[model samples]
Target: MSAEEVHNRISMLRAERGVSRKDLAAALGVHYQTIGYLERGEYSPSLFLALRIAEYFGVPVEVVFSLRPFPRLGSEVVK
Candidate 1:
């Protein structure tokens, strides 16, 4: 069996938005370390938290999390 993995773009999104980990953590009602863990792929957010994060960032939930690694933004997809 493959090891469980949850891929997210929290760090990239946060960087693009210029949002601090502490600030997002406070807004999400979680410890700042939780944000770090999520960013580092050491933890995955709950459904509620995932929705909250998407809403907070003003993006679709699909923009934040995915079952597969996403192509780089603005990069063309290979055929």
Candidate 2:
């Protein structure tokens, strides 16, 4: 899969926990934009950052991120 197919587990976990992006950002000591970027696939976080996010969400890292097979260019994958 192309790197863009790397999904951020943060969004899903946040939804599950009812945690807002702002709250996560505060916990991570980052700007809210950083969270938004990660959630939108516009940014790929470092391993350390990924671990931090997963820790904050009280989940294993793999639960949040996955190397999904790359979809066809004009198609999409539903969650």
Candidate 3:
């Protein structure tokens, strides 16, 4: 079976929190380049890493990661 792509908001969260990739990587005990790979969807994080990322952002895992694509910002609001 083909592997499903895991979607994430790591980049957005990092931006909102004023975090640098190197800083985040250091916090997560991963290589800085790994953060770039994750942001680019070129690599998928392990479950443990995903949970750690969510914990770092003080948000639920679902908020940070999703199997389906997340809606654009403010797209849920009705005009």
Candidate 4:
């Protein structure tokens, strides 16, 4: 079976938290470059790693990773 592309908000979350890729990588026990690869959508993380990332950010896993593309902020229309 083919693997699907996993979408994530790592970069946006990092920026919002003022966390650096290196710091996040270290916290996740992964190479710093891996964080960059994830942010750029060049690599898909394992479920374990995904959970760890969410834990690091103190959010639910769905908040960090999604099967569908997340909508951009301010893209929603109010009724």
Candidate 5:
């Protein structure tokens, strides 16, 4: 099976809001590392957390997360 395609382009949103990680963490009731991980795309949040993040940013969950087809992996695949 292919892995799910995930992208966490949150840095731009953070910058646009002018809020620090610590602040968001507090608002989200998670550790600062959680925010760090999320922003880095190293973590995929649960539905609740995704909703919290979207609410924090005043954006829709669809804006923060999306599903796309995973790229095939093999020599036959095109770049």
Candidate 6:
């Protein structure tokens, strides 16, 4: 099947969790470069991989990836 453009919050979530790509990749049982590829949108992860990542980050899969661009945090807030 054709892969969809799955935008994700991988970088942001990893940063917030103080996780390096290598650490996350090791936890996900993938090569460290796979994390880079995912972060750069150069590769789309399989559903199982995506779910595993979501579990690692303590968030739902939808919170980690979306088919459409997600709105920026606080973008809905007024000054």
Candidate 3, residue 35: how far the Cα is off, in Å: 0.4
lDDT of 2 by residue, 1-79 (tens): 6745677667767888899989999999999999999988888888899889888878888877777733433575443
Query: Which sections of candidate 3 miss by over 4 Å?
Result: none
lDDT of 1 by residue, 1-39 (tens): 135677888989999999999999999999999999998
TM-score of each: 0.86, 0.78, 0.92, 0.92, 0.76, 0.91
Tell me the tens digit of each residue's lDDT in model 3 across 41-66. Answer: 88989999999999999999999998
Q: How big is the positional error of residue 65 in model 6, measured in Å on the Cα after superposition? A: 0.6
The stretch of ten residues in a row with the least summed lDDT in candidate 1 is: 1-10
Question: What are the runs in model 2 whose C-alpha is more than 4 Å off?
Answer: 69-79
Clashing pairs in 6: none
TM-score of decoy 6: 0.91
Q: What are the per-model C-alpha RMSD values against the true structure?
A: 2.1, 5.1, 2.0, 2.2, 6.6, 2.6
- Which 10 successive residues of model 2 have the least lDDT summed? 70-79
Model 6 regions lying over 4 Å from their true place: 1-3
lDDT of 5 at 26: 94
Q: Which clashing pairs does model 5 show?
A: none
Candidate 2, residue 51: how far the Cα is off, in Å: 0.4
- Alpha-carbon local distance difference test for all models: 0.89, 0.80, 0.94, 0.94, 0.77, 0.94
Between candidates 1 and 4, name the one with more favorable TM-score.
Answer: 4
Report how far off residue 78 is in candidate 5 (Å).
Answer: 24
Clashing pairs in 3: none
